[model samples]
Target: MATELNTPQNRVRFGEFEFDCITRELKKSGRVMRLEPQPAKVLSVLVHKAGEIVTRQELIRTVWGADTFVDFDQGLNYAIRRIRAALEDDADAPRFLETVPKLGYRLIALISSSPNSELEDANHTASLPSTTLPRLYWVAIGASVLILVLFLAGPAIISEFRRPSPQIAEPVSSIAVLPLRNLSADPEQEYFSDGMTDELITDLAKSNKLRVTSHTSVERYKNTRVPLPEIAKQLGVDAIIEGTVMRSAGRVRITVQLIDSRSDQHLWADSYERDLNDILKLQDEVATQIASKIGSHIISPTDARMAVRDVSSNPNKQPIRPLNIEAHDAYLKGRYWWHRRGTEAETRGLQFFQRAVDLDPTYAPAWAGIADSYAVMAHHGGLQANEAMPKAETAALKALALDDSLAEAHASLALIKFSYYWDYATADEEFRRAIELDPNYATAHHWYSHYLVFAGRFEQALSEIQIARQLDPYSVSINTWSALIYYYQGQYERSAAQFRSTLELDPAFGPFVADDLARVYEQQENYPEAIKEHQLEWTAAGRPKDGELLRNAFLAGGPDGYWRRRVSLLKPVGRSGIGSALQLALVYSHMRDREQTLRWLEYAYQEHSPWINFMARDPEFAWLRTEPQFENLESRIGLLASGTR
Candidate 1:
């Protein structure tokens, strides 16, 4: 049955939204929505045919007409995606729109709360435009010659398929891959989706033509209700890639769409399905297609299509090898936990990585995960460096032996070499090699920046850290390093500003950077601001009483009393992040008690505090730079000769 609304009343309402066909306007709660002409036309057609199937070909003819030819499939899909975005609809469990597999689309939302609102004439709601109508100039042909005439039009029909898609736009130079939704509707499958997100980012980053935001950065938007343009702005990317992944039985399916961040327009969309065992090849294929669509990674659209076709025809193309699926699963689980960031999280990550290796001892990525987990554990205080560093080294070497091309393995190894072995030259080589292998690895840039800062190469460090920030702008650690490096270069004003900017950028990131900012204020001799920041830090650390006590001490006896009070409150170091010996050493350094400062430094060194390596770099220790014990300690750690290793 044909459906229609009162003419010029030419409007329909669904799910709190009202659409006017004549005006081509969509509004929610009286606020007009952005619905471009093309997408608006598509929506009008669907709304008029509410609760009915609109076949792909029928919609194409009605909307584009025979005279205005284009890549019909891509155009239609882009239009549908834009409409869905406007309606805030989900493809998997749509509220207003639904996809009819192998058929077309159906406007499933109740219109004007009536099912029998029908009057199907072409002009009922919004008549089809002339450009959308098919012309039949030779329709009077005789039956016997009709078949011959259609056969003669075969070339033209094929040519119709090659028309340029309207979705094409100016190529974007950068993009962020938001975490893919888990379409399995099972929480257990979240790891699979997250793992796929990481792999997609990794593969896309391989294109020198584009900058792919770090997975850690985009994961911040996984389930948040933030606006798309706002997310793009925060990520500082030209485009955004959002998608969904589903795994069923032994097969996996993924659907992704690219959007222009500036206009929130759907620029391109594609879907891929593959056997679970060949997921690696499937990921590479998807990445290649997306990269080509967004930049000059594949030269041109024609070249992109040919390259995809050649994946099967080209003998040089690598075949899809069977993966040790269980081991791969375990490795993914390891990564999922590793990103959680804490002593307990690292322990869980280590367990899963160990499980992966046990399942397949030669799985290089799994071994690399093991190395990373151990290395982080050391830094996070889950284990003493002396204990974790050796274990990290072993796993890193094993991963390297298995796959020397792995950028992640090289990075983990390089960090360990710098942090423990103090092999400055080798560490530099490894860091460069890791970046050369995968220039988009943000952690490599982040860590290398630290090395450069320690070596007093402030310009190089600033450049590397900025690159890291560009790749992972939302990463608290990466942002914090930029501030720290600035402080190391004696640019106190810049350092304080960076710290304050990072805090304002994400209040959730404030906790990680509050202490750093507090120290920066201390360097400025702004004791009041320093105390205020430290109090916030104490409160965030779940020590409100301690924060109040410190404030009271500052009120009573000024900076001297505050340091003395902190000295009394100092507790021996424990497992992980609690009760750092370095904090006490800094407090003693503030009091200018050389004997106490040296005593606490030795204690921090014994406890393997992650900050021990940078003891000499602490601004608070600047007054005691001439102390022999301090210089002797620096020499003992391989930082004496050139002050960096």
Candidate 2:
């Protein structure tokens, strides 16, 4: 509510709720509630108003920034709504947050900035109805004895009994790690929290028993106002892990709690603090405890000093070494940006990763990061395959040499071997090894799905992509690939619908999704829709289609003229990172011009274009699948030996 305290304070309690100003987190009855960033700021401003009614202008200046816009009223109303929901304050019967019509709002709940403030709160609530309680009131709800005994003797009583207590919850099969909130004063330290979240997820997922959700899947919940039960349900996870990371004065502290989402029950919670130098080891300790609580092995892996190191060739491999603190910090920042995706973000990520390796060349994860950046650059068509893949392979090889157990490095190596060298055998082994080491690694499964589809293992590909989607349900790339799998399998209607659904989730995907949808339309022989979708793709990509030219060509010679016009319109530039050569080949194959298709296919082969890997499975190329020249190109790509040709 409104604060009367004059001095600045780190934490304050108000009406059974605790607010951490630094972390922007609110907790009621010891349970964390989702308060969005905007609402948190509004609440903060109200708390600082010294119990006075905060006018609209005051709120706008303090919470919505100095630049006033036309929508400030709407934005303020939304924030107030969110704050009320989070605090469970009814506008009709306001208890905590209250609105003042024709003005702004006020926090009526008493704010306590001091430790002894609870006494003040008690005196204030004493005159209210029995329904009203002290601000610091601790209610023991359904699990009263468990709380009582825990306060007295704690969970240790379970060991005192011969049989397990009924209070103990069954071990959950799946869990999602919500993004760790950054409690540091500086906002730049956000990457530290994100990186810690990723590390914790990886550590717990190492357990052969646990099905941990991917960071990409849970990332959408960062600073979200959505309720935990709903978030957990969307993720399809049995339990949820929520936490905060605070860094200050060369010291780090992490606090985590596990919640059974279905019942909204707290299973276990703990906090750890250590010098910055030991942050990596501290992370491992937190993971170890959480793993134990989840009914998994007590020790998950090595020390951040804690990842893969095993290799059969070395019977007694040296234990993975602890990382240099600065390098570890840099590496965390690198991964945060990498997770952001897109060309500019990945480039920024690569620079940070380079800094990491320069600071500590022995850090295997940094080398893996380097491999990932280059590999992604190639995949995004930001760099040529020959240029990017070689660098990726070199870095991945170095990482493996340092610590062969790195699943991320192995996955990166696997993609390079398949997409670049066309070494199917080695790629197969690498992908398997990566998954075996970390079965919950969603990207490994997602990439493996691509290989399966291209190799004509439709059933296996479907299975793998399903698993990938399960682990990373919110990931756009995995969803896109899932749709493409259907397209490759000739399930046109399903693929079209899936692509549309994915595009709905990620509108930025229009440039790519529309292109794929165009193919589905073409396959269905829906010429008008196909042309419209293709035009949408071009316009979204900043290359507006010549609609009149396209329509005229289609009218003159049907699908054949339309495809010929597309070939003429094709630029030297690639589309959605696939080489123009491959795009041309697609057009020619559609026209059933075997000679032109073969010529462009050969060009794609010589360029080592990444899209060439899909030649065996792309339905457009089916017409030319029997041509001698196409067969020769496939043979060169090692697809013949693999039998996919």
Candidate 3:
């Protein structure tokens, strides 16, 4: 029952079934049926080369591509299973894809005519209009096509895709949660409103049925110049949720609207006015309504109760008093600036967090915010480890003591533990506790993923990152982290793609993404691309690391003039950091300045920078690896230092 074919045309005369590749539809006895992408592709591949033995590797390479991270065996099996499901073919008595023992799979089916030929029949003629048509109609069509091209190809494409639709779909599977805007007369209360918006996003994200965009992902659109549909398209969501928060005289009013993204339609709208004690319930209610509007599976009362279970073992404990509004406001301000992550912003965040604690000593959240701010500052080596680490730890502990259920507090503590003390066990405990408190907290998942990566639990790190991505689907930071993980795992192509995707979302991320791509390309032995990506990163970052790396990569690519250009660039900056010395050594080696290379190596050894640890492994230093001076320099830096100590 072997069949033969050519081209991407879908129709295959095999037994009694016809496979339609165009619509990804399968028809048996003229009845339409659904098929998943993988299965459909497998079937198409088989149909196109019927009667041929498709080797396992060929099948995999054709269907999933060689670079695919999926397990080929598992993917092949899954695809065959889906095909069997569609064809009603039993494994024992296969209609097609007969397993050739010890070799590959053979498609045994009668494949006659190209699927495209079937469209020639009058009744089954292609639905599309003929290329040649009435002149007036064609003119109209040309105008329409021109308009379409303008819209699709223009810069407004992104904005247009983000615009809200006016018509709601029957089934809403995707959504964007726009940041809640502050409608308060006093703009100073903006931080509190923003925090509420973030909390709402968290609550919505907990529902697996709804594809809720993360708070951080959508916060950038608070005062967006882009169109709603474009934003929706950028986030890959079908709908958008927007709201305005107003508070006055100990009362809060929140008005929210849900828009179907595709049609720019408003699907649902509601307003709530209540005391702050009802904030938790209000968020839950809003999430429920959104779920209902979007046709999410209704949670039974019992399930709902379970979902809202308290983190504390004692459920009957009295609720704590709300923190001072002034302190909370200050904390929010601090967090607002902290998220900005610039030099001035970090300093301002530290100041505000401190002021918050001063205003209200028992404000646990504010304390945690202070801890996180210090930790972030310490990350960039802007603050002394002793000065920042202890303060961050103290604030985190105080926050936890005041409110053990605060996930942010636990996350901050975990960060402090891992980054400063390297207390793996304590960090793990705190991370677990944070997840228990707020399962949807993206930062908890992100940091936990990072911890697993550093601990060499790469697969677990990937899983954690996946969870973070699910929660923060559109976050540039999360995407960048994913790229970095891939880069670390030596999946250069995938890492480069992810980095490029990050840049698409935020151009400001170009430098970091380009740097990763440069490293990836270098490892791939694509020296030209490596040099190109490095140059891009250099232009974007203009940092010492970027300049040094670009120069080295250019030299590595084997261009004669590159070294001279690099030396000229470095001469202006002077030597700084481990990277600078490494680059200098590389340039010196290229120029046969053995003495200069040794001097730079000595300088690098004197500085115990983390990158120095990679001296033995970095392929860039291979030229100097055999020298006695280089060996001595490496030994001095303790590049082979054992963690057992």
Candidate 4:
């Protein structure tokens, strides 16, 4: 029999399981199961009430607090799944967990404890509350796992324990290198200056001591009205680097400053003026100096060797004449607008890239920039991949033709291979090459994570995303994508919890994450929670997909006229858009309207809409799975019960 202990410090225990009410960690058989932070909290409550039934309403309020407006079931379900996975129980069978039907779940394991030890641990834990435990546990973990965990203590503790902590940046392990602004009056020579700024950031990224934010996030700060402290705070960086570029005739001059964000003090500053031929060496020297002043470790021989390959050192790359400054300026302009991510800005981005290439046809990076714009269009659904991919491929190939060492060009090509061709093998090759060329290329890690998820490699996917998270620690966009990976991997409860955490950081991401939460609830047969989340999501998106999906959740023939009206509104306008039609069929099928369901199902298959991939896994289609039409459709779509593709 496993020894049992209950202390004022410890909440409960059963068998080898221990729930430290204060710490919110579930240790089973003496091993920590890396539970996503929130689920660990929900489990803490359940462990305390082990023998008694925990009501759904009570659990929701306790886990999510009273002020939260969102539906809590998605979060609750995710918590249960994470806890269950940790317990190593079969989801389909029952041992420690017993679903009490409509009321709630009850933990069925018998708990036994020795009298003396239980009293001591409980007393130790009694001095702490659940909220305080998370921080204390993190401090313990951080002290062991990372040398600089104290810097992230406040933010990490709040995110983990769901309460605000001290407001201070941890010792900085991650930072953003903003572009060096051009102070020169000769606006025409701005490109040469901007190019130097970008090159310095690239050089510094090779240092493992710092995780640099991607160029997109840093570009938002250029020429902005925000103060350095505000910019650093918003980006969650401990320090910031600013610089200015000036060029006269054919020579270039650069000035740089490094600021300690917390104290608003200038840590280091430097000035450099050099000829066109010395530009590359100047950038490398600036990066080295900044690293030295900012307490970064000595640059490894690998980094030094790579920097030595600069064009300034290897004169054979370009002659020391007047540089093509206009082309470099155009490229910077393209990058500036590209980061804005709007439809019109995307169009302007292409114009800038084209102009850069026209002025300097041999400019490999400009071609890579064009490839990036096309890839963005494909990603945002503005252009179908078929149209966007060819242009992306062409531009990437051109960039590689001039500079095979260009990481961005490899990333652009890798995107096409992953998104369109579904060629995981080639996509892996391209991404690996991109990282090899520039180990600090965050996009390579981000995109490869998606490939890992779709290929059913969940552990690898998490590892890749962890690297991306290190690079873009404060990017709400990257965080949202991380949640999506959990959702697709059937880790709904974990996914839902992460999505909720993401929304706290970025309210604008709420609508999308809400829709995702509704999907998770519906899959779990939690209809009431599903409907409420769908309602919230529908209002936020103001889109037909959400409302239409919600309507399906309620179309169980209880109200015939209501079902008919909802169906009419949801039906797709055009015959070609079969995705919408599929939604209508699902609603009708649930409503017992067999004739309409079969009709739309036939139409969906014929249109080859991607929605057909859901047929085998969709809970809505559970009834239809035994039908001959379902088999035929599955066979035609090449979908199997096990994820075929």
Q: For every model in order, what is the number of clashing pairs?
A: 1, 2, 25, 19
Arranged by TM-score, best first = 2, 1, 3, 4
Note the Cα lDDT for every prediction shown.
0.74, 0.76, 0.64, 0.63
Candidate 4 lDDT over residue span 1-645, tens digit each: 321223333444565666555555555644444454446656765655666787888777666566433336755775687578767776678567667779987777764331225223432322234453444334434333342343235321122332122133345565667777555555664555556656776777866577666766676577776777788887777778876665655666565656677766545454565565455556677777777666574243222211212233455543323335677668878866666665578878888999998997777778999998888776654555557778988999888766677788998888777665555567779988887766667777887776676556778988888787766654555676687777666677887788777777667666556655766665566666666665676676466575655456467542454456556656553433323656777778767676787788877666443334545544466677777776776666544433533
What are the TM-scores, per candidate, against the unseen true structure? 0.75, 0.76, 0.56, 0.55
| Better by lDDT, candidate 3 or 2 | 2
Cα RMSD for predicted model 1: 9.9
List CA RMSD, all candidates. 9.9, 9.9, 20.7, 21.9
Per-residue lDDT tens digits for candidate 1, residues 437-551, read 7888999999888778767787998999899999999888899989988787678999998988888878887667877887788778787887777777788878878767877
Candidate 2 positional error at 152, Å: 24
Off by over 4 Å in 3: 1-175, 185-192, 205-211, 225-230, 237-239, 248-251, 260-267, 274-319, 524-645
Q: Candidate 3 on 340-407: residue-level lDDT in tens?
A: 77657888988998998899787766788888888776655456555677898999988776667677
Worst 10 residues of 3 by lDDT: 156-165
User: Clashing residue pairs, candidate 1?
Assistant: 65-132
Q: lDDT of candidate 2?
A: 0.76
Model 4 RMSD vs true structure: 21.9
Q: What is the lDDT of residue 328 in candidate 1?
A: 82
